[model samples]
Target: MPHVIVKMYPGSSEEQKEKIAQEITNVIIKHTGKPEEAISIAIAEVTEDLWIQEVYDKEISPNKESLYKKPGY
Candidate 1:
């Protein structure tokens, strides 16, 4: 099974989130060969003020060893 966590600022509509989840699920199925039923996804919404410490420092910075893809900073 493959799990995906999507973190973004709040305000996206339910319809948009649904499309995003479906699209991402398709991508995961294509790449990892995971079945749709076995995949899990979660969307985490955080405020801009807390984005740095919550995501950048905690996930993008110190977790390089486990990250396979990252955006240019």
Candidate 2:
């Protein structure tokens, strides 16, 4: 069971989010051999003002070893 959470600046439309989720699901299925029904994706809209404290600092910075692609910022 794998759950993916994507946190980004808010602006994407529902269709865009759906497409992104589908693509992510496809990749996860391809790599992990997990069925679509076993994967869950969540998109969280984080504002720029709160991104550092809420995301980068708390999540990315602390989990650098786990990150596959680190942010340049």
Candidate 3:
């Protein structure tokens, strides 16, 4: 069994997380020969204030503005 944990800034949608989990499972299956049923994934969303970039010493804000942008700009 393979246990995968993904940590990202808070505010990701369910659909996005689901897609990420699926992609991670696919990679595990392809490289490690793990069965789909045996793969487990967990996504941990840290709040902006808590998720600080060590090099920058700053929190990364969620990309709320980009969500409404037109596809091609």
lDDT of candidate 3 at residue 46, scale 0 to 100: 71
Off by over 4 Å in 2: none
Which residue pairs overlap in candidate 1's backbone?
A: none
Q: List candidate 3 stretches off by more than 4 Å.
A: 53-73
Query: Alpha carbon lDDT of residue 66, candidate 2?
Result: 92
Q: What lDDT score goes with residue 4 in model 2?
A: 94
lDDT of 1: 0.91
Worst 10-residue lDDT window for candidate 1 reads 64-73
Top candidate (TM-score): 2
Per-residue CA lDDT of candidate 1, range 13-37, in tens?
9999999999999999998998999
Model 3's TM-score against the true structure: 0.67
CA-lDDT, candidates in order: 0.91, 0.96, 0.74
For model 3, residues 2-61, the per-residue Cα lDDT tens digits are: 897777777789999999999999999999997999999999887666655521133223
Order of models, best TM-score first? 2, 1, 3
Instruction: Kindly report which residue stretches of model 1 are placed more than 4 angstroms away from their true locations once superposed.
Output: none
